[model samples]
Structure formats: structure tokens, C-alpha cells
Target: GRGQAPATGQAPPPEGNLRARLTSFVGREEDIRVIGDDLARARLVTLLGAGGAGKTRLSQEAAEAHARVGGGWPDGVWFVGLAPVDDAEDVAQAALAAVGARDTKLRGAAAEELRVLAELTSDSDPLHRLVEHCGRRRMLIVLDNCEHLVDAAARLAEELLARCPGVQVLATSREPLGVPGELLRPVEPLPPEPALQLFADRGAAARPGFRVEDDLPAATEICRRLDGLPLAIELAAARLRLLSPRQIADRLDDRFRLLTSGSRTVLPRQQTLRAVVDWSWDLLDEGERTVLRRLSVFAGGCALAAAEAVCADGRLDALDVDALLGSLVDKSLVVAAPGDLGADGMRYRLLETVAEYAAERLAEAGDDKEATERRHLTYYRELARTTEPRLRGRGQRAADRLLSTEHENLHTALRRALAAGEVGELLCLVHALSWYWQLHDLRAESRHWSGAVAALGPDPFA
Candidate 1:
């Protein structure tokens, strides 16, 4: 039964076993529709996002939806999983197996071609065979988890698109395949309504008769804290058998460990939130890893200047910060957005789960966490002091907007100041942020911090 090809008349196992997922799919209706539209037009469409952001799940749903509508992929859909692959050379073989395309003849031809076209050909080339095998059939192929073998995946997609005009590829990866003419659809977190619905559906699985509407506010809070990440929300919902929604929300501050227990039926990496992140983390180069660990000192996100200030240590360089950050962003470990943090044009952030993992790594590397924190605090503190004067008179609104953007960082700095018992530092932050607090109607918080300063016996500066 093992080595036999399907009988000449057999239908070839209904599109290559796209893996019968055990969990119920929820949300992403728009993603499905948009991706389906893209697939109809483009030869290669990649669903890109951070790990656990549901790129694979969303792509699977999209492929199924496209198939249901008969979007011209008539030959069949095939799924090539790259998670189990380590070397790039293995990519072609994995793809051939997924499509049930015999490569024995082509393998021999490839060896001979390498001898003839020694300077122009690759040894053991599988892409050429795959392209020839599928040349006559219109089909959809899903390349799952292409981050580790991005270059090979890109090359394959490029060649397939160029040679096999009848082939359409829908790929899922943390980054784009970077091949020409690739359409990228970034998978984002589920919206609140869909997120809550997903939470309810999975929660009921964990505990029958579980109702989300009973404590709507608490349930909503849980989704918000987890950033509506589907994997995280699913993991949190799985704990409904033992923990309340409120309890889940409360423990999310240490979510790296809190959300570790996931359903056993999924992949080992998918079995825990941390494991999913670890899978991606292991793919980074040393430079990217070092930058990510240092960037964890930030709370919300930081400007390029702020990241360079805190992250440029012995292991990383200030000059290389931009390139390193770009690489992290490319891998979906760091997120870049247009914001007011600096003149560098974009702000970057790690997902909360990712940042927490980086923090743990920073601790493990014997890196000085205190020194990193101090640098972050010092940078933001100086930023606040410099911006305080600018917040007055004509530049008030611009200064206010800038401070609003960095509000989380400022609060984090103040918390660090309090924890370190630095009375003078606390006073400076409280004074600098006073107008910002008043502008934002945070008088209660202002009063609380000022009260703490008042209880410090005497002004250290005085």
C-alpha cells in the first residue's frame, strides 16, 4: 500500500489532505473574501503575519472558500508543509511529495543536467520537474510555514509562476516570500465582535454551557488584554474549565507562562502560546535575536531613536539598529507603524507575548536587565523633561499629541522610578507629565503619584 501511485483512474485523494483541523474555525470572513479575490488574479498570494496571528488557519479557510466557489483552480489544491524542513534543498522534494508528482526520472535528468550545465544549474533540482509535472493543470497549492525556507520558497513560487501559468500559490509565512509579483495579505487579530464569538465558541468546548454574555465586560476585557490574537484567545478560553474570564485577564501580565497550556490535538508548538513563539524565535540570526532582547525594555513601542538608545550594547550596535529592526520587522517579530515617536518615519513594537519572551531571554543571557531598564527610563525621562517646556504656549497641541503617543512608556518609566525608590527621579517625571496628565484628564493618576512623592519625607533635591 505504501509505494503505490493511485490507480490510473483514481481522483488523487481530494486535494492532497489539507489536514483535517479538529478545531472549529471562526471569524476572518473579510480575510477569506479578500484573499479569494487575490488568488483569482495573482499566481502567488502570501498571508503574512506574526506566528499565532492565524496566517495558516486563515489561509486554509481562504483556500477552502476559493475551492467552494470554483475560483478556477481545477487541477486540485495541494499543501506543502515547511515546518518539518530544515535545509532549503529539501523544499522541492517536500513539494513534489505533496503533489504526488513522481520525481525519479526528473531526478536523474537533474543529475545529468548538472554535469552538462555545471555553471548554470543546481544539483538535484526539483522545481523544474514540478513545473513540468503541473504544466497542463490549473491548480491551487498552499505553501504552509515558509519562513524558515523563505528563499527556497520564493524561488519555487517565482519559477512556478513564470513557468506553470496554470498554477496558483497561496502561501502562509511570518514574512513575504520576496519573489516578484507576490501579493501579501497581512493577517491581523480578530476584531472585538468576532473575537468574542470565537472566545464563546471555544469556551463552550472547554466547559459546556459556558456563556460569554453573562459577564460581557469581563469577557471583553479578557479579549482586549490578549490583543484579540486568536491563538492566545483560544488558549485562554481552554482554561475556562478551571479559571474565570476575570482570572484569565488578571494573569495575562505574565501570559508567556499563563497561556502555555493549549489543546493537545494541535502541533506541539501550537500546544502552547510560548511554544508557537519559540518556533519563530529559533529562526532568527544572532543580530536579530540580540536586538529583539534589548527592544523588550519598551512597553508600548519605541521610535528608532529610542530603540537605538536602549538596544545598542556590546552585542548590538547603534549604527546597525535600523537594519536589525528592519530584519526583525521582516520576520514579523517586530511590528512597524507610522507614528509620532521620532523623525525616523516609523515606530516599531514586539507583540506583548514576544516582548515577554525576549525579556526572559535577556535575563537568561546574563544581560543587565537593570541597566537596560535604567537606559530606557533615562531616555524617556529626558524626553519628558525636554518636551515639558514645549508643551506650553504655541506648541501645546503637537507636544500633547507626542506625549499621548508615548503615554505607556512614560507610565512605565514612572513605575520604574517608584520601584527603584528614586525620589528625585519620580518628582521630575511627575512634574514633567503634570500637564500631560491634566491635558488627558488623568488628574486622579497625577494626584496619586504626587501623593506618593509627598510621602517621601523630603525632596531629595532640596
Candidate 2:
């Protein structure tokens, strides 16, 4: 997800927002191929991910690689950024302006044909005119940041796909476009190796001769804590001009404060980690917001049943937790693993950075913090109490696997219970987990919690 990896040799010609990247694009070789393949067969393809997870960078690279390969898009690859385009109705005009730039790069009959399109920019119905022009042209139109005006983006994509015989679309959105034939591809966070490579690459770019191996552990931890998000990694790398890697890693607890001063040229949201998340946060409705913040109580992620128990009351009132959680997942505010729990059991999580954002929201919104956590504590403690017996015989393996997945939640509940001076709940939790802990050989952790249960009181996150 390196935004500006320096690709070797002749790169795709720059156009619209797809400037020939100044740096070699990193770690999306497979993605580029997949996108190219998808576009070959599908008319509409949308890249989906949490904000700041490199959807834009990946889409741009994929589109560029497709164009670089040639023969696929004879009219060229075009990128139209819908981020600054505020209204749905204006999507057509913004697109016309973007694709109109294509005319300048063409020659002969192709150039003349697009020149006709450039002149039609002022048409009374720009969409129809634009579609009529593209009706037979083989081109890749990259609709960037379409989540905010998704309905319009979807409608536009649908019309183009249906009417234009040779047009293909590559859209980057936090959510799916919901168009019938649209392909949704999730751009995940970088794994350890690539995340470290990205950090080292950006770190050296920020400060000449900077090396990640000089302080491998700190750099590793920084990437790990940032959950391998490229924008976050890039922002942290920028701090190398001033701070040591250790210093940067140490201050990441206040990341929104420390990871600042990104390149001022990009959109304000892309310029800062907080702003990037804020853009996504602003897109959510109140129910989605509530479920998101409350679910932040889970140290890792939790099953839907656990989410319902912990987040469905309070201001959520009669709203269905399942639907709310699903909406959050659709919006990319939450990540769901469909098979983690069982056939139909989906486990959901927020990215650690996004969890921090949700925690901040929880604190800012007030009293729901304690109420939601209390429910979380109650749910896990009761789960422990119930699962205790199941740990003994015929059900031991099933129970152990389930509890293992929830071990972080159990530990989280133990700490929260201790902080709140709920000695009674703490005792029950420890007593229930005592054998499970020993079974998993968590001697030290067992000792720590068993000791804490005896010593109770103070210190837990809000």
C-alpha cells in the first residue's frame, strides 16, 4: 500500500488524478493483476476498505498497470475524484471534466472523436452526452472516493455498464455501490513484511539514509500498532525527520496528535491519519456510530451475539443490533469474519486505529461508556461461568476453541472488573477460568489475574 513506490521502467502515462507515481508502487502486484482480470470480465469493479487502508493508492496503481499493459483500454484510463465533488447530481459534470482530459492525449480519429466529447461538456444532459460518446470506446474510468455519493456513483456506473459496450469502471469506495454486476474487492492492511518495507521506504524518504533495521524492534512495533495501515505508516514515517523511531513508537498512544504534518498538497483527510478516519466517521448514521463505539469495548473482536448483548440497549433502544452491526460492516467501519464463530457466526472487529477512534467517541459521548462496558463484563463473565463445565468432558475441545477465541475478551473483562472494584464478578470470572487457564498453560497470566482477583481495584481504559 505504498502510495508512491517507484516502479521500474516506463510507467503508465499520467492523466487526471492518476499522476505517473513519483515513487515505485509497493506491494500490490497481485492486486493489480486481479483488478486487471476483473475489469477484463466485469464492467464495474469497486475497491472497498476502511478509510486510510490504501484503496485509492491500490486503485490508481491497478488502473495504471492496466493502461500500461495497453490494448485493453484504447481510449485510455481516466480517474475522476469524487471526494471534492459534494453533490450527487454534480457527479456527471465532474466525470465529464475528468474524461474530457482524455481528448488532449489522443491523436487522429480517436482525438477527433474525444474532441467532440470535450465540446459536449456543456451539454444540457452531460451524462447522456458523455455516455453516447463512450458507448463504443474501450476505456477504464476510475471513479475515486465514491462512498459519500455512492448512490449517484452506482447509478452512473450502472448506466455506463448497461449502455456502453466496451467501458469498464474501477471505483474506490469505503462501501459497496450495490449495483447488480459490480465486483467488490476489499483492500486489506499490509502484512508485517510489506508494512515494514513501507515504513523503511517512507522513513528513508523522509530523512536521508534512515534505516528501519537500525531499530528493528521499534519499527516493527510501530507498524504492528498502526495495524499496517499505509497512510498511518506514512504519517509516522514523516515524523522520522524530527523524532527517532523509538520516540515515534512511544508516542503512538496519542497517535492522532503525534502523526501529523503529512504532505499538505493532498486532500486534508488524506493528509492526516485522524482526518482520514474523520472523513469515514462523518459518513456514518447515529446507529452505526453507536454500535461502532460500543463494540470498541472488545479488546479484539466479538461475535454478533456478544455485540447485541453489550451494545443494543441505552440509546440504541429498539434498534436491531444485527442490522446495525451489518450496516457498520458494510460501511467498512467494522471488519467481519464469517466463519470465525461457526457456519453463520460472524465475528466483527474494528482496526486498532479505528478502535481508538471509537473509544474516543465513546468517551466524548459520555455515560454509555460505563453502561456498555458493564454489559460487556457481564456477558463474558457469564460466558465463562457457563463454559466452565463444558471444559471438562465431551465438549472440551469445542469449549476450549471458543474460549480461546474469546481469551482476549475474558482478559479484558477481568481487567475492567478489577478496575471497577467488582470483586464479586472478578472472583466468579477467575474461578470459572481457573481450569481453562491451566489447560492452556497460561500459568503467568493465570497467576496475574488470580492475584488481581485477590487484590482488586483501579486502572482500565474508558
Candidate 3:
């Protein structure tokens, strides 16, 4: 049942085994249409997103939709699951088995087909034989879970796209295969209405009499707190069998503990909130993990210089921060966006769930949480000190905008300083941020910060 070649004169299977789902597919009609359009043009299309963002489920739905639409991928849509297979060398073999597995059913030669399928290509190269087999068929091959063996998957996709004129590939991965002409579609979290609908749908399924309107606000807040991730919503909905929507929303700080009700039929990683992220966390190298762990200290996301100052050390140089951050982004562990500054505007952040996991990792690793926070404190203190002067000059608006961006970080640093009784640093931060705080009209917050500073017994610097 490993990599095997088709028997000569063995007829091709008329169609594929993209399994029909039992649950109602919700809130992704537009996404389905977009994927249809992308598949219409690109030979290789990868649906990229973090684990449990429902890429595989979405891909299956898209394939089924395409099959119904017809005229494209005429031979059929074949699903080759790469999740259970770990070795890069075995990907071709798994694919060979999947495409041929369907055919064995059609011929009604189950016993004979198994024998023939097992006999061929056990000695020869399975990949070369697979490409040859697919050479003539017009089909869409769904390559699911390629992130674990990305390079090999890319090679297989490249080979098929180059040699098989009629075959198209629709892949689902946490990252791209980097193959030429590979169309990438990033799967984002569901929006509010859709997220609520999904939560309510799954929640009612969990408890027959459950209604989101029973606790509308709490239901909406639950979706918001979970970042609208479909898997998280489903897991939370499963809690309805025991807890109320309000109770679930309140316990999200312990989401790893609370949201464990995933489907038994799915992969183990998909069976829990922590397990979903743990799968991604295991994929990172040491340097990437270290950076990610340190990054958890940040409240609002940081810019390049902030990350370098807070995250880098002797093991990982300041220069490695950008590359590692970019790598994390590529792997879907981090989210990056353009900020207020031009050219140097990319701000990097983790999802709330991811940041929580990284924090847990940081604690478990015992990697100087206070030191990281202190560096975070020092970085923003200097930023505020530098920007304070610029705020009165021609660069006033730009400086204010930058300072405004770090509002949460600045407040966090201020609170940490006050807690540490670092009165000297506390005073400097208060002074530095005082102007920007006033400009932003945070008088109540300003008064509270001033009062905290005044209550610090005596001014050592003075």
C-alpha cells in the first residue's frame, strides 16, 4: 500500500473521493466563489492560513463546488491527504495510493486491486510513475497539509504542473509551496455576523434548544475574543452542552483549558485549542521560537527596531530579527501589516491566541520574562523621550502618530515601571509621555499616572 504504479490496461477511475461533509458549510460563499475563479486560471492554488483556520474544510467545499459546476477538471477531483504521512519521500507514494484507491472501487476488484497496487513501484521511483500516470488525465488534485513537507510537495506540484498539461493542484498549507504560478489565497478569521452565525450554528447543534439571541452580547463577545477563528468558535459552541455563552466568554483567558471539545474524527491537533497552536509551534526552529516567546511581552504589536531590541541576543543577533519575523509571517504564526511610517512601516504581531501560547512557552522555558519586559520598557521609554522633542518640531504630526501607535505599549511600560518601584525610570516615562498624553486628551489617564508617580515616596533623581 506504499508507493505503487497502476497496472497496465487498468482503467482510470471516472471521478475522485472528495468526501461529503456531514455538517452544514457556513459563511464562506464569497470565499468559495473566489477560489473557483483562482482555480479557473492558476494551475497551482494554495489556501494559506494558520492551523484550524479551516483551510482543508474550505478546500474540500471548493472542490465539491467545482465538481458541481463541471466543464473543468473533467476526470474528477482527487483528494490526497498528506497529514498522516510524515516523510517527504513518501508523499508521492501517498498520492499514488489515493488516486488509485478510488479506481479499485470502480472495477469491483478490491482484493486483486490491492495486490496489484502493492506490487508496482515498490522498487521504482513512485513520483516519476505518478507524474506519468497523471500525464493524460484532466483533474484537480487536492494536496492537503503540505506545510510539514513543503519542499517535497513543491517539487511534486512543480513536476505535475510542468508535465501534466491537464492536471491542476489545489493545496492547503500554513505557508506557500513557493512554486512558480502558484496562486495563494490567505484564509482569514470569519467576520462578526458570519462568526456569530457559525457559533450559533455549531452551538445549537451541540445543544438542540440553544439560541444565541438568549445571550446576544455575550455570544458576540465570545466570537470577538476568539478572533473569529472557526475551530475556536466550534470548540466554544461545544461548551454549550455544559456552560452558557457568558461563562465561555469569561473563561477564554484559560482557553487552552476551556476549548477542548473538537471533533474526534479530525486529527489530534485539531481536537483542542492548544493542540492547534502546538502543531505550528513545533515547526519553528530555536531562534524563531525564542523570538516568538519574547514577543509575547508586547501588548500592541512592535515595529522592527522594537522587536530587535526586545528579542535579539548573543544566540540570535539583532540582524536575525527581521528574517525570523518574516519567516514567522510566512509560516502563519505572525501577522504583518503596514503602519504609519513609510518604507519602515511593517508592524509584526501575533494573534491573541498565539501570543497567549507564546507567553505560556516563555513561562515554561523560564526565559527571563522580567528582563524581556524591562527591555520592552527601556525601548519605549527611549522612543517616547526621542519623540517628545520631535513633537514640538516640524515632525510633530509624524512623531505624534508614531507615539499614538505605541499607546498600549507605553501604558504597559508605565505600569511595569510603577510596579517595579523604578521611580527614576517611571518619572522619565511620565515626563516623556506627558506631552503626547495631553495631545491625545488623555487627561484622566494622565492624572492617574501623575498621582502614581507623586505617591512614590521621594524623587531619587531630584
Top-scoring candidate (TM-score): 3
RMSD of 2: 4.8
TM-score of every candidate = 0.86, 0.92, 0.94
The clash numbers for all candidates, in the given order, read 0, 6, 0
Candidate 2 Cα outliers beyond 4 Å, as residue runs: 1-17, 104-118, 314-319, 338-341, 456-462
Candidate 3 positional error at 57, Å: 0.8
Question: Which TM-score value belongs to model 3?
Answer: 0.94
Q: Write one digit per residue (lDDT tens) for candidate 1, span 1-462.
A: 211111222333345446666878787766777886777667899988888888887777667656655557667778888888889998977887677532232445766544533322243566776776778878888999999899999998888888888998999999889988899888887899999999999999999999999889989988887777899999999989899988888888888778877877678888888898888889888888888888888988988889999888775678888788888888888988988635654888887778888999988877478888888989999999999998887988878887888889999998999888888888899999998888779889999999987876486678
Q: What does candidate 3's lDDT look like per residue over 1-462, in tens digits?
A: 101211212333336887757998778877887888888778899999988788999988777666665627777889989999889999999898887665566556678888767754564899887887789999989999999999999999999999999999999999999999999999998889999999989998999989999999999999998888999999999999999999998999999999998899998989999999998988889988988999998987989999999998767778898789888999998888898788898898888999999999888875468778889999989998988999889999999889888888998899999999998888899999888888889899889889899888486578
What's the best-to-worst order under lDDT? 3, 2, 1
**Candidate 3: C-alpha RMSD after superposition:** 5.7
Candidate with top lDDT is 3
Give the C-alpha miss distance for residue 372 in model 3, angstroms: 1.4
TM-score of 2: 0.92
